[model samples]
Target: MTLEENAREHPYEPVPGDVVRDAATRRVGRVMDRMGLRVQLRPLNGGREWDAMPQDLSPASQSDAMSAAVAEANAQSWRGR
Candidate 1:
């Protein structure tokens, strides 16, 4: 079978809390929920959520996740000042 056929048969499905990158937006977010074929994602630092097709998402790299966490931490630290 062709790659397209195989992909259709077995699409990538990310569960809630999984970090992923949206190919369409080139943004990293955590899976918030799924609605039919579309998946909801929220920024790591916490912001408005957006919906993206499963086909447009892939697992985020470890560095991406860490970078977001560090950025959030830095923001929080500044807020405490």
Candidate 2:
């Protein structure tokens, strides 16, 4: 299978916009899809798993912070795996 297929089968990486609510740590993922940057999101009450892309994400003021967090999460995830 191709690399993408392999990743899908064994998702060692997190996809962009995955709502991660693991225990006390909670975050909405805002990944740089091309770079696979996984940012931690500020918790919300409840919403769909996928959200608008960072460029088109609502409440645009937070885009920069979200992107930075995603980059950090991507780095950390890659290192851990």
Candidate 3:
């Protein structure tokens, strides 16, 4: 499919707490919440939240997903949370 079509039909459909990547800013974050037509995303490492249009984001790249998953696993192992 075309790029615009793909962007519109983005497969992720982010939910709160799920990780996502913004196309415009190239920022990877966790979905925090939704407000109207915008989605709120917070830094995966904990920081201020930002608003982004859901259509502007895609699923995190495989490498990024792996890195985040490894980090999360390590954090869970260390913190027991």
Candidate 4:
């Protein structure tokens, strides 16, 4: 099978630093690590990490990523007050 075919057979897996969404929780986070079939995700604003099943993860949309970043900035500003 061609590389493209192989890739199609295997779903895309996120690497560390990749922003993704957890469909199960409808939350956006960065991929920290992967253990077996579970993927570790940490919030864009920084917080506790959680393990999510690979099947439940999808690449975050541009809008979603921007929203997360804005939320983090807002949180930082609030804390500085």
Cα lDDT of candidate 4 equals 0.90
What are the TM-scores, per candidate, against the unseen true structure?
Answer: 0.71, 0.26, 0.65, 0.75
Leading candidate by TM-score: 4
Better of 2 and 3 by lDDT: 3
Q: Write the per-residue lDDT of candidate 2 for residues 1-81, one digit (tens) a residue.
A: 998697567654334454333323333343334333333344333223333323323222365446546676677678778
Tens-place lDDT per residue, model 1, 1-81, is 998898789977899999998999978899999998899999898878999999899889999888877877798789989
Over 4 Å off in model 4, which ranges? Answer: 1-8, 79-81
* Ten contiguous residues with the weakest lDDT in model 3: 64-73
In model 3, the clashing pairs are none
Q: Give the TM-score of candidate 1.
A: 0.71
Total backbone collisions for each predicted model: 0, 4, 0, 0
In candidate 4, what are the lDDT values of residues 1-81, reduced to their tens digit?
Answer: 998698679977899999998999988999999999899999998988999998788889999988987987898899999
Q: Best lDDT goes to which candidate? A: 4
Backbone clash total, candidate 2: 4
Q: Give candidate 2's whole-model lDDT.
A: 0.42
Q: What lDDT would each prediction earn against the true structure?
A: 0.89, 0.42, 0.79, 0.90
Poorly placed runs, candidate 2 (over 4 Å): 1-60
Residue 53 accuracy (lDDT) in model 1: 90
